[model samples]
Target: MTAMNTFENKRFLARIRGGDFAHPGEEEAIDLVLSHVKPQPRETVLDAGCGLGATADAIGKKTGAVVVGVDLDAESVRHANATYRDFQFIPGDVTKLGELALPKMDVIYAFNSLYACPDLDACFASFNEVANPGARIGVFDYIAYDAGALAATGCLPPSVHSMTQMRQLPERQGWACTGIVNLDLAYAAWYARFLARMDENREMLAAVRSPEVFEAVRKRYADMLHCLEQGTLGGALHLYARA
Candidate 1:
């Protein structure tokens, strides 16, 4: 239940913002989120645990929705606010979401945020509490076996998702699943591309990130490669629900 520290999270955030190793399928994943939302020009949206706010910015610009991005990472919040001024990046904890002065939201995007929280149910509950009834909720997460066995092999990060456990929780809380999209093929391709990019542009990557961060990321890529090779890992997932 240990949360990622500031330094580690910052390094991960940096790669997400500017690294040459972003998954190729990432854009498609975002598109899927947008497709589900179909936000109107005047709707209010919440990008819970928005990370760098890439998805939030995209939604805001595309639909003219008032998107509010929130994250527990202070550095990430700062970067999102500074980098995407059009969107409001608020510093807050998703596990304790009600304290923020957010408006009634039409959509809540838990993009890749569930796995990062120590207690998934608590996190979901917080989102449920803040959301308007019938509000749309979208979640994209890295799903894996216990302790992410496949990730240890090399090509992906060590991540896990109790999807079976998660799906039931939302329903128990009154949110029904509307869709579940499997991005395994897309994730595998992205991992390959990311590893190749690292191999092809080692010097450039080193220049963009600190030596320590570069080494850390290099290890992560190596781990992902190994996992893919072993076939122990399967996929990343996206789910849509309604409160």
Candidate 2:
């Protein structure tokens, strides 16, 4: 796996996400999770693979949940801790949550993060370990409708799974999938807006990022749009409960 720092610079991520996020429609996605999970005050919420702790901060503020953000990237964790003082950011791996000494959680979420995990079963097992009996697990991530086309584009991570696979993996690990929202249309719309924003600020982005980096970012968005249009790549919001 590539070091997080190599491809995920803070400034570039900020530009792409329009702030502290690293994914499209992150706030809206979090709202969806909030609706499904319905966290209460003093309940524990874990933001697995939390990049920069943006979602953790938002959830902590909105739902009054005791939010804890974890990521494998030490630098990202450091920056998250510095930027979001109200929430706790820990440098840890989602697949190894047992060693993190985290409290049992009422809700756990991953925003565009689970696709990068190489071992979905192990990751879900770890989630099961740290979750209360009735804990909710929400994941918003890319779903490859046509794996061949998605692989051809090479825009997404190697571990991107189809919707069926996603559901089955969690089910095998003691999670009962309650809902799966097909968000392909929403994702495409988000990509359209993202493309427009990128174009509007192309020069500004170019100025901050290296030529190679800027082009790579641009190509990634373009490829995602193309794949979505081709009916190959898409997104989904998955909701699950501990069985």
Candidate 3:
């Protein structure tokens, strides 16, 4: 599996987020994913690109499923192991999951993580290899609505896809997309709350992060807000089953 430290702002991000998640409304998103997947006890589940194992730990506790998280960052894996002892965190790459000696997963989910994958088709193909029959896949991620605006922000990964492409690509890779929930409004609301939280903790953040870092993070959020408001970018929750 490949390992790289792509999340350079992870520490400061954790501080601003007040947790391990990289996006807003993470808890609610987790609940939504879990409800859609409905993992069974004793089933093995995979949290691809799990950061700090927060969502993985929550999944394990809630479903009594044997949950394992994999990420490309060894430091994040080490931190996750130390912090969330109930679940296992390993250093690996999501695109190469077929090569990992892990148990077949009954449910696989990625929350705002798949965008980093350089090849979505290869990733899904590997996922199919590691999945048990009828296994479900849940992903919640940003969808590009206006290509020009999305490119202008330069925040999203180069591999980011449109909502139609996201659904189509997975289906072509042998997964049947059963549902697609548009979360654009919810995303906007989350950003609104996130900005408010940042404002509320401005002093604390300023003390921990440099002025430049603080401003950069704030600007990134502001840009995202603008994109959402302009219908340039959106969010979606997708559910799929092995075909």
Candidate 4:
């Protein structure tokens, strides 16, 4: 079980979220996405960079969709597979979904994962190869706000993207941009709630990996919250449909 990643037997996340998830908004984010585009029982949804299979499982339970979970991290995939049986979890790259032998996707969903990708344009194009015509894509992730502030801080990942680029790239890759939302306020609030939850369950969270690791995670997220509040980093929900 890794300390920072959403993998393995980390029951502490469930303690905070009441289920396994790797991003902000927890249940609220899921409900919002489902309200926009949910796959039917006959359809298959691809969970791009699905961290722990929890998001995919959540979608399955809500819509009866056949969900396939994919992640670049093999350990996360293995852990997700071991914990969840109703869905298939496999280790693969989001930028190359077509290379895998999985079924074509009707809807693609990612929870705070796509922003970390090195080549989002390539990822969008590759997803097109594995997606059925008219497939919808939804992503909740970090969006860049102040480039100068982001550069000044070493905490945020370099892949943090602007909302415009996020829209333009996907649209250029055969996706029709349905909408793009700025979730900066929501992201700040989420981090606050998450930090409060972690503090409330400090001892339990610390026990999962180690006290040292837990503190490191706490500090990292605290810094993230600071960035969000400072307008250096933000969050957003992007929606697109295959054209």
Q: Where does model 3 exceed 4 Å of error? A: 1-8
Best-to-worst order by lDDT is 2, 4, 3, 1
Q: How close is candidate 3 to the true structure, as a TM-score?
A: 0.94
Q: Which has the greatest TM-score?
A: 2
- Give the lDDT of residue 19 in candidate 1: 33
Kindly list the per-residue Cα lDDT of model 1 for residues 1-243, writing each as its tens digit: 123335354445346435311223456667776776677897888988777667788778989999999888777788788888998988899877888888888888866666666576677778776887768877766566445465344433343555575677777767776777776666667667666766677777677766676667767656655554455544544454664
Candidate scoring better on TM-score of 1 and 2: 2
Query: What is candidate 4's lDDT per residue for 66-90, written digit by digit as tens?
Result: 9999998888788789888889998
* Backbone clashes in model 4, listed as residue pairs: none
Where is the poorest 10-residue window by lDDT in model 3?
1-10
Best by lDDT: 2
Identify the runs in model 4 with alpha carbons over 4 angstroms from their true place.
Answer: 1-3, 6-16
Which structure is stronger by TM-score: 2 or 3? 2
Total backbone clashes of model 3? 0
Candidate number that wins on lDDT, 2 or 3: 2
TM-score of each: 0.83, 0.95, 0.94, 0.91
Q: For residues 60-104, what per-residue lDDT tens digits would candidate 2 score against the true structure?
A: 999888999999888889989999999999999999999998999
lDDT of each: 0.67, 0.84, 0.82, 0.82
* Candidate 3 per-residue lDDT over residues 5-114, each given as its tens digit: 24546666666667778756778878877878888898999999998778898889999999999998898889899999988998988988877888899999898888
Prediction 1 global C-alpha lDDT:
0.67
